[model samples]
Target: MKKTITFLTVLLVSINMYAQENLDLLTYAHTQDINFFNSIKNGTQVKEYITVSKNSVKIGDTLILGTPTSEEMSIRTYSGSYGTKARGGVAQSRSTSKKTYEFIQMGRPAGFGSIMAAMNGDAASMADNSLKNTTVIVNEIKTYHRGSKNKPLYVVMVLGELNGKAFGINKYLSVMDTELAVESGEILLKNRKMTRDEAIAKLKEAKELMGIDMMSKEDFEALKKELAPIITYKNQE
Candidate 1:
């Protein structure tokens, strides 16, 4: 009985290790070939969904996408000496410039009334008083297939309201940005589990890239401890 138990434990561990190696290879492949990742097609038909808090929106309501400007300054200095022994003074001047090209508009304006009517009055609302506070909803949705199984890749346009004012929030939903993408219909795909040795190797490479040397020893230990479970392999089956 003891011998059988030990053998089972070793078998499980080996299986877990193999799974981790597969996951690492897949992740590496996706990073190397983005078009290959995006080319994957799934059979799922994408649908639009919306969630809102506050008063219902209608047609003719204005939606604003505000983009604040950025400014930078460059300085130059000159030094000169005249009519004095070992006397010199430095003068410096700076010119301020603004960057106007970084602004991005995700989508064109759509009337709130027309949008609500188009959906056959499918809507939601939440009540709040602060003029600056607003609830955002995915008003327009598009999808494409990505990955080997052709999983759906959802891109959505977000709309919001502050007080009685309507506005546009974002054009694209991306995983790198925030968790809100999930609410906006972004799909989360499963990755294969990794084994202990493979996890450690991958983590070491990540630590080097993250400049762990820049962190205090305590901070480094804290971060590692927090991430240890995430990097460690577990049996999914």
Candidate 2:
């Protein structure tokens, strides 16, 4: 019995190790991506169903895709002397005139949200992402590494094709200074097992009703239970 248990434990550990190895470990620079990164890591600790990674994904798995945000960068130029003026009479850091340009999110993602985001961004949101109601299923999973560092960044990209139902969101978070092209934030990889978008919307409505005492706690609870699955990213931080 002891030998059997030991072998089982070792097998389980090995399986987990293999899964982690096949997964992509990525880093995010934006607030939205950072939050998503943190949430995915934290969420896994609290729930079970699946973990977001390449190894766990297979062909035909439905996925929510991210849209393009800011693929361009603007320039800011400044000029001056060691003072306020080009020939500073007063003491100040020699600065020049100023010219600045930035990419801002208009709270929307450019088209081709699937390929672009998968290649560049770190996360995707279930709610308020680029393609609201449109669904994508995995067509391919590609893995690669970049950079010259000892630990190169490994990316496992999911190439998806539209399942085609509906698209668009009631609301979406925007990246500052970017106007369509790439939205590098608010990528939601965390999920609540919902079969329909209306389910989440209904839950939000119910919560609102409960808050205003239009619905009793018991009634809201009942509704929530019937809705099954969990959350809606209505006011996520």
Candidate 3:
């Protein structure tokens, strides 16, 4: 019985060590993510603007706006006979091919009033409306390095309020905010690693703060699952 107890104690120690190692790794990753996010938030210092159309705005939704110069391309093909009629009499062959390219404008930022009008289905009346541009409070910024190292795509979420309601919107901006805009506003930006318990508590607070019930059930579940791993160690501790 004494030998069994000794072995159990050793096993328990091993498990504890393993758990600690995992916790350490998680803390490191969390810290890295937070740091990267802050670098994007704090690194750049210009305030540029883009024009968004009235049709695609949502209230209480975070808006991700790209610069004014992004373009989307579409390729189309057409087929036809160019050769002379090849009836046995003409003795001619026929070949057919055609291609077309269409370029669409994308990533344009919209004025706050236009967005609000679009959301309210009053875009027509607001077509010539002149409203001062509202400032966007950026919350998070991420970048994707595609192909060229110099020109990476930026993903950003900004805090916006319209019609007296506040919410977050995520947008893919061609230019990083840090590259073009200075951070403004009083949103608390997380800059340090959080303990599992603290992280879980923050998640609960965010849910209530964001009106989780207003989000689709699927989205709420997915958000919970995404944060679950970070907080999973809470119960074990």
Instruction: Report the Cα lDDT for candidate 2.
Output: 0.37
lDDT for each of the candidates? Answer: 0.34, 0.37, 0.33
For model 2, what is the error of residue 135's alpha carbon versus the real structure, in angstroms, after optimal superposition?
4.4
State the local distance difference test value for candidate 3. Answer: 0.33
Q: Which is the leading candidate under TM-score? A: 2
Give TM per candidate: 0.25, 0.28, 0.19
Residue 80 in candidate 2, Cα distance off native in Å: 19
Total residue pair clashes for candidate 1: 10
Per-residue C-alpha lDDT of model 2 across residues 137-203, encoded as one tens digit per residue: 5433322223222222222323233544233531322222111111232222324233345577898
Q: Quick one: best lDDT, which candidate?
A: 2
Candidate 1: worst-modelled 10 consecutive residues by lDDT: 18-27
- TM-score of candidate 3 on Cα atoms, chains taken together: 0.19
Off by over 4 Å in 1: 1-106, 109-137, 145-154, 168-219, 229-237
Which stretches in model 2 have alpha-carbon errors above 4 Å?
1-49, 52-56, 66-135, 142-155, 160-208, 223-237
